[model samples]
Target: MMDFPLKPVDHRVLLPVMMILNGVSLATAINLVVSLDPEDKITSKRGSALTLLGFIYFMSLSEILNMTALYTGLGHRYRNKFRLNSGDVLDITNKFVSAVQAAFSCVTGAIVCLWSCTRDFMRTSHYMSEAYAWFGAAYFFYDIWSMYIVHLKMYSKRRPFKNGSTLLSSGDGASVKKPDTSFLAYCKHEPVILMHHLFIGGFGFLVIVYLRGDLGDCTFGFVYLMELSTPFVSARGILSRLKLKSSRLYLINGLLMLATFFVCRVISLPYVCYLYSKVIGSSYIDAVKSLPTGCKISISILLLPQLYWFYLMCSGALKMLLPSSAALSAGDAKRRS
Candidate 1:
């Protein structure tokens, strides 16, 4: 099963889930590109070096942005609501950052992807791709760090510390010293999401930026748009926290989330494949058959998780959208049994 960190999410952490995911992704992307052979046309060793610097700079900046949002007003307001536990402060911060990122990504994607035409989707990487791609990468570098903080804080809240003692939980309910609150623990709680970020952060960079021989950067731009649904996802979680589930605004957000998730993520792979087939002058079926096995595998690796999330979303939506059935057969039967 896919575990997503959302409602009843992290309490006190530095950045949001997606921001952490974004930071880690940005750093990984830069490092991956830097390690590649310098024969590539898209980036040079020096350029990669410069981008690394930018990555670090941006990672710090992302935290500042997150902290600014949290410590000032929003965090305090959200934290006080819980009264007993403040761990949710971090979780709220995490969501705020994710929403911000989604907004930035949507704009960035549109500015770059729609600047020209779809013909260049697989054959151009000159302007915006070259200029802003690295900036996008920096976001990942910051987000990975953010994800860890929230996860750790949330873990601490879940298990709690014994005054001055170092007792903690290893995320599996077992007690340990200070807990495993390391990257490994974060990975355990958010494995699928972390992997999704990692794949996009590391390998996706190669395909979108480097492997195209400096072409189709616009396609890379489209990847940003894939995050279009992220804000809604974060918003949904926030509204849930606010206990606004039945509000009309919540309902609207949920519907938009479903639409965007379906359009941007669920069918994104097939749409890409369709575009690829069109580019190659072949039917979609033939194109799929002709694609390298590795490509097919990569697509599957990205697609399946999305489908799983969509399934979970639909199920959750049904529960949320429909009126409660107090006398559910399962509830009655379980009581009787």
Candidate 2:
């Protein structure tokens, strides 16, 4: 009999779940994008909304890639079991390549951010507006590159058969050795870790976008800084799991809540800023009105890299958190039996 049953509720189940989430996010983004009033020059409110919507789109796309990766990764693990001809070796290779590409894209994003910041700083106040425009453009290009890399990785992992036979083949001309399916089984039952990471990464990217002035007019750099701290918070949870201790889970949860608070606050800052500026004086209103329509286009263009990063982090977090519960339970039952 097969040692590891091919259960229906394996990692494969996550694909549809992620797909549904992606659909929802996509719809939200499209709605937000369509709602923009063309008559109004792009204000901070519009820019912020666009940035959030763009990030949502990026998240959706990343989740799709992540689902594909998880499917292939789990499939490779399964093939390793029962000495079957698992065509997952290539998939694994593709995933690694994808990781490398993602890293490169991140580096590129960082560079672009630095360059824009530098240019803006060098320019006088007269050029401040133009500087912001340039930064937005840079961000957009960076995001496109990052998104393309993600798509490439997902596409590369599609063909599993080629890798399964060539790389996963056992040396003895027998089927490959089965892996301890328990690992994947364990993953399904404990998906919180993944979710936490996703939230942090997604929020972190938003913070970065906000920093680049691509999101809104609010100078909420502090909030962005707070959101950026999420990875460290999640790292604590990972450490707890590795050490087999639940002592830090509460602390991690606290941090997650704090991060969520910041995310919401930061997202809402545009409206807050608008209200504040309106109350301050007509000067602010005139200044906002003076911004060219191209500024909005620039911000949208530049915010893409940050959006991609946010999506990557969110997708990675989800992958880490949600494990295949059925697979885990089956393994446990088999071991106990």
Query: Poorest 10 consecutive residues of model 2 by lDDT?
Result: 122-131
What tens-digit string does per-residue lDDT give for candidate 1 at 1-337? 0123423224234345435654665566556555544224444654465456555545544454445444446645655664424345555656776777677678767766665334465654434454345545655656776778767666665533457556556789997655566787778878888888778766775665565554455555666778999999999987776767879999999999999999988886688788888888999999999988877888888888889999999998887766456348568889999
Query: Where does candidate 2 stray beyond 4 Å?
Result: 1-129, 158-337
Q: Once all C-alphas are superposed, what RMSD does model 1 give against the true structure?
A: 8.2
User: How do all models score by TM-score?
Assistant: 0.73, 0.26
The clash count of every prediction, one per candidate, is 23, 18
lDDT of 2 by residue, 1-337 (tens): 0112234466467557657765775466346434533212344564555455444444444445544533466644644452323123223322333343233333333433343333332121221222223222333333433433433343343334644522244678776643323434434543443333333344334434343343332232222222343344344433443343334564455456445534533333344335445544546556456545754453344344345545655654554455576568789999999
**Candidate 1, overall lDDT?**
0.65
| Top candidate (TM-score) | 1
lDDT of 2: 0.40
